[model samples]
Target: MYTYTEFDEAFVRNRVAQFRGQVNRRLDGSLTEDEFKPLRLMNGLYLQLHAYMLRVAIPYGTLNSGQMRQLAYLADKWDKGYGHFTTRQNIQYNWPKLGDVPDMLDALADVGMHAIQTSGNTIRNVTADHFAGAAADEIEDPRPVAELLRQWSTDHPEFQFLPRKFKIAVTGSPTDRAVTKAHDIGLRMVRNAAGEPGFEVIVGGGLGRTPMIGKVINEFLPKADLLPYCEAIVATYNLLGRRDNKYKARIKITVHENGLDTFRELVDARFAEIRGEFSGVDQKILAGIEAQFAPPPLRQAETTSFEVRYAADPVFRSWADTNLSAHKSADHAIVTVSIKKQGQTPGDATSDQMRLLADIAATHAYDELRISHEQNVILPHVHKSDLPAIYDALASVELATANVGLVSDIIACPGMDYCALATARSIPVAQTIATRFDELKLEHEIGPLKIKISGCINACGHHHVGHIGILGLDRAGVENYQITLGGDGTETAVIGERTGPGFAYDEIVPAIERLIGAYLNIRQSDDETFIETYRRLGMEPFKDALYGESARSGRAHAA
Candidate 1:
């Protein structure tokens, strides 16, 4: 993880102090809510439907044990006793009092974290693959570049008031664990003919009212040119992007309205003009950031304990099979501690749970931790020998659900439970679905399934990319859910197609169960995942099952 430099520390402290003054003014009634809205939003504060919510940025989703403990402290001392780790890899505190926000910001600054740009129409958190450094398939660790982007984008004057909020994601692997194609700017590390490590720069990809798979603008952007090239892209979007309708303000719409070829030409022209501005200072800073992310030393250890436990304990074996990923070091494994335990709020971790994770990371994970976009806590470099101990500690806290990539392991936003924009309740729906599936004990048999739920069209829950996506909406003042099948957020990214009509809130869970049942029936084998089956059979079989044969045939396809 990158250690904060003096400049970084001072920058955050200054922002906190400024926000404190702004909060005082609002509290004193010197600034009306109208006047204070932008001020508060600039610092990552939001006026939710019920209360003030603060989203603290976790840049590149990398932090240390101490930082994680500080987050727990903020959760307990300021707002609720838990924080919601969001899809952007940040944490959101839902019930903060307005007056207490500055103190919370102060606490965050003390640990080199803040909420700056987390809410504003500025460059949001620059997220990277959670398993960046440790993933066995990585071309390189993408965090250094992500960090460099974070530093560059922070308080950038030109980008401060873009057409809309911008998001960028980076991944160093061929397998897109970071959901790069779903970001406004997706940078995938690749090698040139000379084996030189560079990036395949993608632009205009996003999920929301208008979901789009980003198109590649530059096939191989040299490492030296990344900063300037990105600046050029955002600069181009800032100028050409729509401002009339908020719904069409995203770069995706801009790219769609004006073809990618036209947009690329503009970006290329902008790149030429500003390319000279970057010079080599960015490279020098990146070098320093790269040093901070040097992989933690790993020592070889015997795996007899892990082997014996796997053979003797089915529980531990189940958890291992589902939650663990291969690490670059053969002796190590990437442990994704499931925060989406059955019947709990997905992405939520209590103070005690947070502290335990901090302790676990300190002891076994080289003092490093990661917040995955899938709403899970990751101990990216745990030795295989330490798996049993970590599992037991997690199990004691209800965080040891072996449901990673399983149906019960869901990706859901706070939805109507917290978000003001939510049209229907996502938490309870997710909870019911998870509990129902757990009761049936069909998760293991179902294999890998991505069930993402969004309470609204904003796509905060990322329902657009789930292999099985459920979108909550209000139809005639009633909670209704529309299902989208085969949406995937991967290297092979595809926006899900909506299954005709919508189900009431009561019917949503059973509707999903029926969809899964359809999968089981159509699949050649259990090994054929939900996505694989959907790809093989198209939407007909599932559509037929979802709405019987008559309803399926009568349903008119919407373009």
Candidate 2:
């Protein structure tokens, strides 16, 4: 919600013009695909499986109604009829013409949004908690800091071309909703022993060929030192991060090789030298950004008896149980609009649905909306009394699925369907899993289970963090899938271990059903979730169920 200043406006305008010229050259054969690749990547354009995809950054996943409407406009006017909200809380338009991207950038800029730094080796969109400001459990709102990072990292001369793409995520809540440990740089807003809010800075965590949870670089980094410390970390990575091999280029490799103590020393040495340079500039910028995020005024009234409403309507009660969260205010609740329908691509929202959400946000939910890392949309501050109206509006648009935190509410990426890098179709696999579970009526019975799918090992779908993780792979030109068990995305985060042999494209769904069925049979009580049961009796049983006879074969094809 940060308003663009004159400086910000000028910068985006220049970027748009530059990209326009680049697109013109590409169209007229002045620039070949080889020449235009980096330029387009810098502008957040990618040549995907079918067409060019434009990834627009929704910084910190914060957007107003105007910006949402603009995204809807772009989806309707330029790209396909819908957009895909990503795990990073950004949006990808899968069918934008090369020439019209400049116009799309213009449309975004008109609403104070842009695609800059949404991709490439530079720092990607800074992500944070979707319920940052509105959550009752937050220590402080993290968007101001996320916004500050956005400004500081934009075309930063030193970090424009790092060894690999860098990601940073911040969260102010005790509950780790942002999955901070799975990012390149994780900032957990914490209160120091002195009771002053600072950050617990974690460095070098990432997922790919070599997954690592970040180590704490600094236990308590003062709020004022955020920019300088971050710069120091990026500078250190730029200088020492691996460039010899693309596979080993992430900061995780560097941190892992150098050891945390040595890396911390280097970052501290760099921080000491640059700390003075950031003295007043960041304070001024952060103050301005914080002002933009001031909470909307709420009318003083007695809290609604939401329990009474729940007792009356079973459907509403089911939805309220799954879709709503306790708000900071007494009479309000945070509503998560599940994009994971029973049998649809995860995170796909049609243009009309987007427009409808924008309208509803403006009318009933404080004109603010958030794109969550779970591939869902959030009405972050909805009054309890308005649930029925919001639910009706969202239901009409196919956004009111009551499956939040359920097994069927999976997170997946645009796999072979859109991503050129993908070797398998992740969306369809996720859809089939959801549909099968719904058919069995086993989702609610199974309780909270995170089933995340990644098209490839890049782990954009966060398969590494799911309670039940699925990884799509290519085996001898055929699509295959692997499953991992005991993974968790929480304060106590842990990477899952592979169950056994990979499943063929056709065999993956039934294999998943088999695993879930095994969990249900082995669970001591119906109250035992998949995660709890997994913790109680490791992955041995699930592995046996998934690979009944060929448990020791370790083949790519299940049968």
Candidate 3:
């Protein structure tokens, strides 16, 4: 984890002071709610259904044990005793007092964290792979680069007010866990044909009312020019992106109108001009940043004992099987603390749970934790020998839910409950689906399936990429649900296609159950996962089942 320097420390302290003054003004009527809304939102404070919601930036979803403890403290003392971990690797408190937000910000600042850039139409938090350091096939950990971008983009004067919120994701592993294809700017760390480290830069890929996969602007850009090239891309978007219509203001729209070839030409032209001027500065900053991310010293020890323990403890074995990923070092493993409890909201972690996670991280995980895009916490570098002990502690905290990569482990967005833009509820939908799957006891049997739910077309839940995607919509003042199939959020990413007509809110769970049942019956074998079966058989069967007797009769007659 990158520690905040004196400069960074002071900057955050001053920002807290600044926001405190703004809050005071708003409370005293010196500033109207209309005037204060944007300012408050910019600081991650949102006026929600019944109260204000405060979103805290987790900075590429990496946090130390101490920081995690601080987050727990904030949840316990300020808002409710629980915090919701979001899809972007951040956390949200749904019921924070407007006046207390500054105090909360101060508390976060004390722990080398803040809420800056968590909201509003500016560059949002930069996300990266949760398995960055531990993944076996990574070129290099992407967090250090993500951290560099975080530092440079914080209150970046040039990008303070962009056309709309911009999101950037980086992935070093070929697996694409970061969902880089769906971001405004996606960077895939790659090696050139000549065998040199660089980035395959993709731009204008985004999801919203309109979803488009990013196009590669540069097939290969050297590592040294990473920052400068990114700066140029964002700068181009900043200057040329639309500002008149909020709906059409994103860079994706700009790319859609301009075409990729012309956009590439413009970006190339801009990159050539700015490369020399700030390339040196980027290098200097990255050098400092790299020093911050140097690996912690590890004591080499055997982990064969863990494999033996796994054979003995069924609970530990199931947890180890579902939640653990192999690490680059044979002595260690990546342990994901599942926040997806069977019936609770997929990502809600109580204050006590957060504190326990922090303690667990400090004790057995090298004091490091990461929040995954799938709405789970990760202990990135745990020694395999410590697996049993770590598993025991996490089980005590209710963080040992063995549903990772399973059907009950859902990714969802905060819908009508908190987001003003949302029309229907997403969390409840996810909850119902999870409950239904758990009841069936068919989750593991379904194999690795991704079910993502977005409150609206914005796709905040990344519903567009789920193996079975559900989108919540408000139709004629009634809640309606839309389903999409064949989506995959991985190295072989593909946008899902909408099934038949949208189902009413009450019909959603049954519809999902029917689709899954259809899959089970038609699959070639139990060995085939839902995604694999869907891909092998296509949407005709699933669509036939989903559309009820009408489609069934149509298929029968046609046959």
RMSD of each: 3.0, 2.7, 2.6
**Which one is best on TM-score?**
1
Local distance difference test values of all predictions, in order: 0.92, 0.89, 0.87
Tens-digit per-residue lDDT, 379-450, candidate 1: 999989988899999999999999999998899988998888999999999999999888888889889999
lDDT of 3 by residue, 1-559 (tens): 7889999999999989999999999989999999998898789888888899999999989999999999999999998899999889999998888889999999999889999999998889999999987798899888889998998899999998999999999999877999898889999989978878788898988877887788888988888888878888999999889999988999989998989888888888999998889848877888888888777676578888798999888878888888888888878888888898888888899999998888888888889999999999998888888888888888887878889998889999989878888989998888888887887778878778899999988899998899999999999999999999988767677889999799898888878888887887888998898888988889899887877685434332211
Taking all chains together, each candidate's TM-score versus the true structure is 0.98, 0.97, 0.97
Model 2 stretches with alpha carbons more than 4 Å out: 302-308, 549-559
Of 1 and 2, the candidate ranking higher by lDDT: 1
Worst lDDT run of 10 residues, candidate 1, spans 550-559
- Candidate 1 backbone collisions, by pair: none
